[model samples]
Target: MAQRIRVGIVFGGASSEHDVSCMTAGGVSRAIDAQRFEVIGIGITPSGRWVQVAADELRDLRKQGGTLPRLSESRPTAVLLPGQAGGARVATIEGDRLTDVHDFDVAFALLHGPFGEDGTVQGLFEMLGLRYVGSGVAASANGMDKDLMKRHLAASGLPGCRFVTVTARQWSQQREQSLARIAGLGFPVFVKPARGGSSVGITKVDRVDDLEPAVLLAQKFDPKLVIEEGVANAREVEFAVLGGRGGPPRVSLPGEIVMRQAGAFYDFEAKYVSDDDAALLVPTQMDEELRQRSADVAARTFEAMGAEGLARVDLFVTADGRVLVNEINTMPGFTHISMFPSLWAVSGVGYTELISDLIDQALERPVGLR
Candidate 1:
């Protein structure tokens, strides 16, 4: 019998999206192929402690009652140590004693938001010479920052929503000038943390009176902000992109996020808290030409961002038929119900096969300086 590959499923993080990450880990754990891969659950606590989690424990990660799941610090503390010959190992730490050291082959990082998704963890993996799923350090960093992502897309000649960036220093030093630049985007702008995800720190401002308060709220999540002009009469659609094996990246059929409530954006609450506010439609109806155009743009966005393994490209389809790029999620939500998996499912890839394919992709890639 062939040896089962030991896969490190890294989840949880010191980000606002930590709970979401935990949920994603649970979903992946449930769907991943058990016969071919040995699952090693590695979770990071909200306070930034790495701990080893059992497969059963990861399976139980879910929202109970109204509370989202969090990693318990009580689990044995864990760490990833550099291995000989460009590989990695995982071991548990008890006080000052290290034990249960095991060879860890590939890392399926299910972490979302800052510490994990913004290239910090990727950089660590690079230094350790370990191959992992998702984009490399530079691509992960660019995808995490909305301001940089938009700028990158623009430089690649892609269409995006009109927006302005405001850093903490700039906002404080040139308050009036910054506000003036934002005002140029007109009212009804989306104030968002430049590097935050899962809609944790986003606010839709209808007028100038609400703009500053929205900016302040977003600043709590990230010091830099990207306030974009809201697309009028636009439908929120998303596409899932997966790296091809020795070929171009693959783009899935589009999915649509339909907000059931009037004037309610797809906020954090709508995403995780309430289930009735938003409906996910896979293989959403679209003109053949528009669909092709959207897919082309999404694939281009993934390639231009230098993303690898997998990514989710979000786009806004205006009623007038203009398709504008919203942003690319290098590490998108992987829950069974998440749009990324749903899009692929409709595109003929089941959840389990999708998970297996991603692991295979990671294993096929070279570790260093790729």
Candidate 2:
């Protein structure tokens, strides 16, 4: 029999989405094929401590309770050192002894938000010459920053709503100027952390009076904030793109997000905690032509951003039939119900297959520039 591949699943971080990342890790660990791969769970605490976790523990996280699960600080500390071609790579310290763990052929990073998703971890992987899943450094960095993402998408001919990027320095020193520029975009705008996900720090403001507070709130997650003009009577649609290692990007059938809460947006609660309140309709009710267009745009966005492995492209379809590209999540949520894997599920790739395919793609792709 062929040897099983050693796969390291990394999750949790100092980001605000730490709980969500843990959930993602749980889902992935549960779905990964056991016979084909040997899995290792690595957890990063909220305080930036790295620890080793048991696969069984990671798989049972969701069954815990209402409160989110976190990586406890009590776990044994883990240190990573490159393997000599094929040997143990992880070292755990127990008193004066050092125990070496198995070497990982590939790393599946399920972390989200700033420190994890903003290319910091990806850069580390590059430095370590390790094969890891998801986008490269530049793509991850651009995907995390809304302003740069919009610019790259726009430059690639994708249309989106008008937005103003406010840095910490500008928001503090040129408060009036920043507010004035945002005002030009009109009301009913979304104030968001430039480098956040799962709608962690986002606010919808319909009046000028609420803008300042929203901006300040968003700034808590990221020093840079993006204030975007909201599309009136627009439907939120998403497309999942997957590709790498010589193949062209394949976009999944578009999906629509319908919020059950009255006048409520898809915020963090609506996405993770209270996600049952929202419905994800695969193959949106839009006309076939529009669905095709959305898929095309999503594929283009993936290629333009140089995204590898996978990405979830969100779009706003106006009532007038115009499609506006919203943003891209290079390392999107991957729970059972998360749009990235769900969309692909509807497109015929099951969750387990999806996870295995991502690992295969990472292994096939080399560590350096292509």
Candidate 3:
């Protein structure tokens, strides 16, 4: 029999989305083939400590609010040595300094937000000469920041939202100047951390007066900020693109997010906490013309960003019926109800099959300056 591949499931990151990352890791670990791959859970606490955790324990961590998962309890811990070229390695620390070397074929970085989802972790994988899931370093970095993403999309002729970058230094040094620059873009704008994810520090400032404090709130999360020209009552649509053009990439049926009674927008509460704060219309209610156009935009955004494997392209349908790329999630949510995997599931790809397909892509694709 062939040796089962060892998978290092890296989770828990030093970002606001740390808890969400744990949830994502648990969902992915549960779906990964047990007979095909030996799963090892690596938890990185908010303080950056890399501890090995048992699979069941990882799931239990998610149910901190008096909920429970369907698994027995066991705690596992491991240590990660820092270096990319020698490849990622782990040591099982048990008892009084007793250790054993445990290597994995590839790592499943189920990390979200700044430290993990951004180019940081992917850069390490590049140096280590290892295969991992999601986009490469450049793509990961671009997708993490809304400002750079818009630039790449515009340069590639892919439609995107109008926006400007506000550095923390500039905001602090000349608050008036920064506010003037943002005012030029118009009011009722979106103030977001340039390197944030999961909409943790996103605020919609309708009045010019509210803009400064909004930017300040965003600055708390990241050193950089982005204020985008708000798309007025634009329908929030999403389309999933998988694989690359070398082989035919599949576009999942579009889904629409209809905010019913949530925060002013889809904030952290609406996205992660609220059970049914918004209505998600899958295979969205769109005319064939708009549907096809939305799907095309998804592919274009993915291509323009130079993405590989998979990406969830979010768009805003204008009042006049044009689709504009909001941003791309190179490594989107895979938790049970998350859009990334859920869209594929309804589009004929099961959870287990989706996990297998992603691993297949990582294994088949070569790791280098490609």
Candidate 4:
């Protein structure tokens, strides 16, 4: 029998999206092929401690009592070390003593947001010479920062809404100048933490009177903020991109996010907590020509971001048929209900197969400077 590849499923992080990452890890843990891969759960505590977790412990990760699940620090502390041959090794430490150590072929980092998705962990993997899923360091970092992402997209000639960035230094030292720049974009702008995900620190301001408070709220998550001009009468559509085996990336059928509530955007609660607040329309109805155009743009966005393994590209489709790049999520939400997996499922790839494909792609990818 062929040897089963040991896969390190790293999830849970110090980011505000920690709960979401745990949820994603749970989904992947349950769906990953048990026959072909040996799963090792490495959960990171909210306080930034890495610990070993059993696959079964992560299976039931979900919201309870109106609170999202979090990783427990009680599990044996875990650390990654360089292996003798190449790859990486997972070592579990109990108290002051080393408990167990195992070698992993590839790291499937299911972490979202800052410490994980923003390329910090990817850089660690690069230094350790460990092949991992998703984009490389530069791509992941660019994809995480909304300001940088928009700049890259614009430089690549992708159509998008006009946006202005507010750095912490500028906001404090040159408040008047920052306000003037933002005012140029007009009202009804989205104030968002430039490096946040899961819509954790985003506020849609319809008037100038509410801008300061919104900026304050976003600044709590990230010192830098990217306030974007609102796209009027636009439909939120997303496409999932999977790296092709020694070929161009594959694009999935488009999916639409329909918020049930009036005047409400797809906020954090609407995304994970209250399912009734929004509906995910997979293979959402679209004109053939428009669909092709949007898909092509989504693929371009992925390539422009230099993403690998997988990513989800979000676009704003105006009523006048203009497709604008909203943002690209290098490590999008991956729960079963998340749009990334849902889009692929409708595109004929099941959840299990999708997980397998990502791992296979990561394993096949070259480690260190790709």
Q: Estimate TM-scores for all models.
A: 0.95, 0.93, 0.89, 0.94
- What are the per-residue Cα lDDT tens digits for candidate 2 across 256-350? 99988667888878776774888889767779898888778888889999999999999989888888989899888788887888889989999
> Candidate 2, residue 42: CA error in Å?
1.3
Order by lDDT, highest first: 1, 4, 2, 3
When 3 and 4 are scored with TM-score, the better candidate is 4
lDDT of 3 at 32: 77
- Each model's lDDT comes to 0.90, 0.85, 0.79, 0.89
Cα error, candidate 1, residue 177 (Å): 1.0
Candidate 3: which stretches are off by over 4 Å? 55-78, 81-88, 93-98, 261-263
Report lDDT (Cα) of residue 222, candidate 4. 90
Cα RMSD for predicted model 4: 1.9
Ranking by TM-score: 1, 4, 2, 3
TM-score pick, better of 1 and 2? 1
Candidate 4 local lDDT, 41-151, one digit each (tens):
888998898888876887778677877789977776789998744478888877787777888888999988788888999999888888888899999999999999999
Candidate 4 has what TM-score?
0.94
The CA root-mean-square deviation of candidate 2, after full C-alpha superposition on the true structure, stands at: 2.0
Which residue pairs clash in candidate 1? none
Worst 10 residues of 4 by lDDT: 83-92
RMSD of 1: 1.6
- How much does each candidate deviate from the true structure in C-alpha RMSD? 1.6, 2.0, 3.4, 1.9
What is the lDDT, from 0 to 100, of the residue 344 in candidate 2? 90
